[model samples]
Target: MTKTKIAATSDVSADKVLKSSANGQSVLVAKVGDQYCAIANKCPHLGLPLAKGKYENGVITCPFHGSKFELCSGKNVEWVESFAGIPLPGAAKKLMAMGKTPTDVASFTVTQEGEDLFIEA
Candidate 1:
């Protein structure tokens, strides 16, 4: 499929993120300086909305279970460390993983077209 418009560059400022979806793909556009990174808005660990999570230094931290992903490559940086910024114990964190496994978030190629941003869906 062709790349689709996600959001206007003006809508996403430096160090901020914007959520968009097209062709049934939910993506999060993060602008850091002159570069942009697009990643799936759903956390791979729990299928939660990554748009509601916190992102900083190219790392998007899931609000649930503290799963963190690197936005640029959609790589799993950390998994199930804590919830909402609180640290978790080894046993509890392991139990939370009973039926779930850690996985990296999905990422899409992004480019700027004029004042708008496009993502490959």
Candidate 2:
């Protein structure tokens, strides 16, 4: 994986959000506690930048459509799984059969090197 230095520890606060550019992509960086997390800055649903969203309870809600994604996992709200069942060819049944929990979004790798936050590319 490719990594890029994005910010310093003192640059972000717990429960705060910021937008950064790395690996030719717009990344949304969030600081939760002492940990930093990164995800695509654009909302998966409509290409709106997630930097404009509100962060609360470790989740970010899109400003345009109110779509909520987990800061830690970048997964969509639980309701997305319910809604995804319709066209995925037995997706709900498969989820139940595998005893696997479904998450509606994708997560990016985040690492801290000393006091800096880096995201994988």
**Please, what is the whole-model Cα lDDT of each candidate in the order they appear?**
0.82, 0.69
| Model 2 lDDT per residue over 63-105, tens place | 6545579887888873222222232236654543245344455
Q: Where is the poorest 10-residue window by lDDT in model 2?
A: 79-88
TM-score of each: 0.89, 0.73
TM-score of 1: 0.89
Question: For residues 40-110, what per-residue lDDT tens digits would candidate 1 score against the true structure?
Answer: 89988778898777778888888888888987789998889886778899988897766677788888878
Q: Which candidate ranks first by TM-score, i.e. highest?
A: 1
lDDT of 2 at 121: 74
* Ten residues in sequence with the least summed lDDT for candidate 1: 9-18
- How does candidate 1 score on lDDT? 0.82
